[model samples]
Target chain A: MTAAAADKPKKLVIIDYSGELEKTWATMILASTAGAMEMETTVFVTFWGLQTFVKDKKRITGENWMQKMMSFMQRPGASHRKLSKMNFMGMGPWMMFKLAKKYNVAKPKDLLEMAMAMGVQFLPCQMTMDMFGLKREDLIEGMGEPVGAATALQLMTEADSTLFI
Target chain B: MANLDIKLKVDASGLSCPLPILKATQGIKTVESGELVEVIATDPGSVKDFDAWAKATGNALVEQDSADGKFRFVLRRK
Candidate 1:
């Protein structure tokens, strides 16, 4: 093998498909950790995962009124995400956040911030966004650009490790 | 080593994996190539994390010690 090939940084691609807070917490941690290791890391946000990237809660109304209402009723932004199990109507994430805090575990929001600060790429899935009727304006800042499944496919193909969460 | 005059000392205590390494790596860039930086962390994962970090970042893990589950690491920036 060529020296250049041996020296190339490992690539990590994480596909985030759910909006559960615990799952998101792990995803961001992995992204930031890989990025800190000087690896090329990309987190592909799709489907329900897109909820965590919404900047404006009210503007998330998708194509139809029902979808809009559903989106609006759900959480928005990094901090408001809920856990999938034992959500207790949102108390589960709160308790988990407190527990994580007590144990000095990095909060999901802070992890995401660190991931961005460390240059880990955040790629949004275009087809999922279209299917959900989400507009570009609905997303949070620092979301690099909207890309189709091809981007995720390429990342998965080239990555040394790929995680689906 | 304790005798190594560290130019930058980071109290990464209470910080988790990757953060300790992240802080150390970020701090390492501020010093001269050969200067030393010390890190203290509570995360058990830091032991191996710092080793991997030093390797990946081209820094040298000059010294490492652990006591009471706390970890101490010194690196020479390169």
Candidate 2:
């Protein structure tokens, strides 16, 4: 390989907006794999995604009876029903936690820790934090300063790959 | 026989596509060059995922085995 090509770093930007099974899995995979490739990775959590990384919030594992029942009902090819239930009185996040546990998917907090251990950069959106009355300390540890959407946009623009989940 | 011995195991069982590959990638990073990382996963998609990942990342797939809904692979880091 050419010297320049060998020296160039792979950049990955993962935008996490959903606090669901899909979003968490996508973020963790990208962070861990890209980090392994010695790539520079940045995970930007915005809006509802912030809950996944908040220190005060524990990832809800679907260990409860109700959650277990919900999982049984939502099968593959049941997207519409799943989406509808997700929007029901904050059932979405609860169900997400249950599914994550049922599937053996790593918890968001664990994923964040793994990302940090792997040297992935984690950023929270400044606007969203302010709107939600969240302080920097409210977030999980190892996170850098809250950045604006413009910064995230710039990072995405410069990335080799970008995913919104 | 000693020369072909591969060490390192990552239990990626119960994980889905991209996760198995992703975990294997991370496990390989913690080892020295030329060392092998064995990934054990239950995802049906892992067979193809590992093939694609090995190609994309310049790693060599030394061995692959599947049985009872479990898939295993040994990857040599380049």
Best by TM-score: 1
lDDT of 2: 0.70
Report the C-alpha displacement of residue B26, candidate 1, in angstroms. Answer: 2.9
lDDT of 1 by residue, A45-91 (tens): 99888888777454455888877777778856778888778999878
Per-residue CA lDDT of model 1 for B1-78, tens digit only, reads 346798999998997665787788678878998999998999988898887776765668889999998899988876
Give the TM-score of chain A, superposed on the true chain A, for all candidates in the order listed: 0.89, 0.68
TM-score of 1: 0.89
Give candidate 1's chain B TM-score. Answer: 0.92
Q: In candidate 1, which residue pairs get closer than 3 Å at backbone N, Cα or C atoms, i.e. clash?
A: none
Interface RMSD of candidate number 1: 4.8
